[model samples]
Target: MRRNRLLSAVVAVCATSALGFTVPQTAAADPGSTACSQMPSDLRPTLILGDTGPAVRQAQCLSNMWGGEPPKLVLDGIYGTVMLKKIEWIQVCHGIPQSGVIEDHTWEVLYHPALDCYLPYPD
Candidate 1:
């Protein structure tokens, strides 16, 4: 009877331990995992180096969403050398031409960024 009681206690402890433990789940650490809707501009213009205004700010904000971290481009509504390089890297991530220009395809990427990029951020 004592052996049966000990076995029952052991089984109860095991079950309780199992119930207490929680399995770790895969984390969605990428910033672009969320939808891009709060943009400065709804106009999808063809932005290039030396561009400025609301559309440029929108592009800058969207570009910030890539690379799983803070955007290198300031939301100052101006597209300069930094924005150019970042845009090129973004283009590379999407397997597109690194044209440093925000056209239709680039706009698509800016709106819906990848969860992660195979390439590392450029210097």
Candidate 2:
């Protein structure tokens, strides 16, 4: 039993490490200043191009941590075309489908973004 547990732990560590999971320190949000703080906390909703609310603003802020090459997204409460493109890029970075939709999986990536995205940012 102990040996099994050890093997499981080792596999877990290796899986995470091998996936190149690194969050950029420079773009990380300060604890008290995260965009999620802009509104009262709630469950993240499925957002698309026309949605407008705190959740979209929260997503926009979290998405900014992916680095500034394509430029940071404005923390506006509205979701629009620019935000859609960014979301698509972020999906591609995570090897997810480029759906341009903020659902559970996309929200997961936004909350825990990787530091390096090899693909070029969309124009």
Candidate 3:
């Protein structure tokens, strides 16, 4: 019984070592971190074409979440066409006008994110 117990312990250790990962000791949200909806206030330069920053990253993250076959944004903070198209899709889904601008309502959708709405727009 002692030999079997030692073998099991060795096997467990070997298996964990083979996995080659360090488990996190603890996890916590940053005290200064803002949620996605609150992300708009962090956006600056109005988040128009060619804009880039933390705010843009925030927008990209939300657009990715808002649901579409929309291309995934890299969160690199650049307001490129991919982000633009995804934002428009989200706006349309939420009944906002399909303007590619990440303005008030668009930002709202990004932050709150659950519009529970989408209309069939003719492509």
Candidate 4:
């Protein structure tokens, strides 16, 4: 239970810290297990809400491994809002803008989730 709380706080802090926008603390959710490890590693398409196909699924694979747990997703390759939020959360954690769009910076973080960077990177 404590781990969940900590991850929730991390999510909120990352999101709110991104671009100085304060996201509600309630935005956090609990999930586990990421199939992303098995998904293609080279897929870095800039996905947004409404897009679909293997690219979107690849994005989903990456996002399912952050914070407290992997977000519950269908992996149907549809870039829905849920996945969008997850991607944005990942961006926020990496001090990237929460535009909900995957860019090069996002890919950098996705490619190297452990790549330490300046905390609270300027938006």
Candidate 5:
């Protein structure tokens, strides 16, 4: 009887292990799927010709993401002609449209900063 009980207990343990339970799936599996919806729909560009505040911050962020050599400009939030020129240079280097405006596409590059290849548009 003792040997039979031990064998039965081992069988039960093996059965439970073989039929391992799993937690039910939920919507959290794909976080980015609903990320775009959370953003403001009416968000629009308000680039100032010589205002580099947000633009430069964006550029620096891009620079850091790309692991590229640091840009020669200060991180002041004034988008002056120098910052605009730097933006154009970076865009040209990456073969992006030379809009000289930190638009969505530009912002994508700044945010993602692909290491392998230049991304004209944000993924």
Candidate 6:
């Protein structure tokens, strides 16, 4: 009878332990994973005429990567009409919709010029 009681107690403890334990959940992708997508909305109106210093640098980098040409403009960090024109040119070169806005597709092309032929996944 003592052996049986001990076995029963062991089984009960195991069951209780199992019930208290929980599996941890896996983490999702980082928030910045799709940061490029937000670039359009972030720089909407400013993308038209000109941009600031950092914007100009980003544009120049993108232009150089896409065209394999040296950046002729100065990195004054101003997104002016000239910058807008250049952006349009890039859009034309990449065969993306010429909406005059630096949308997510435009950012992808700018960031990954070498992957011009690659298409982004559907939303």
What's the count of clashing pairs in each model shown?
1, 0, 1, 0, 6, 11
Q: What is the lDDT of candidate 3?
A: 0.63
lDDT of 4 by residue, 56-83 (tens): 7665655553435435567788888777
Structural similarity to truth (TM-score) of each candidate: 0.65, 0.70, 0.57, 0.56, 0.45, 0.45
- Alpha-carbon error at 34 in model 5, in Å? 21
Q: TM-score of the candidate numbered 6?
A: 0.45
> Taking the tens digit of each residue's C-alpha lDDT, what string does model 6 give over 1-123?
999998997887788778995322111112233422323324522354544555555555444443233234555656666656666666776888766577677766666554232333112
Q: List runs of model 2 lying over 4 Å from the truth.
A: 1-23, 26-35, 39-42
lDDT of 6 at 49: 54
Clashing pairs in 2: none
TM-score for model 3?
0.57
Q: For candidate 2, lDDT tens digit of each residue in 28-88? A: 5443345357554346689889999888988888877777587788988889998999999
Prediction 1 global C-alpha lDDT: 0.73
Best by TM-score: 2
Model 4: how far residue 73 lies from native, Å: 2.5
lDDT per residue (tens digit) for residues 14-65 in model 1: 8877899532211221233332333433468898999888778777777776
Per-residue lDDT tens digits for candidate 5, residues 44-83, read 2545456544545445434333334434555565677766
Greater-TM-score candidate between 4 and 5: 4
Determine which window of 10 residues in candidate 3 has minimal summed lDDT.
Answer: 23-32
lDDT of 3 by residue, 40-69 (tens): 454533567788877788777666654433
Candidate 5 residue 82 Cα shift, in angstroms, is: 2.6
Q: What lDDT does the true structure give each of the candidates?
A: 0.73, 0.78, 0.63, 0.62, 0.52, 0.52
Relative to the unseen true structure, what is the C-alpha lDDT of residue 107 in candidate 5, on a scale of 0 to 100?
61
lDDT of 6 at 102: 71
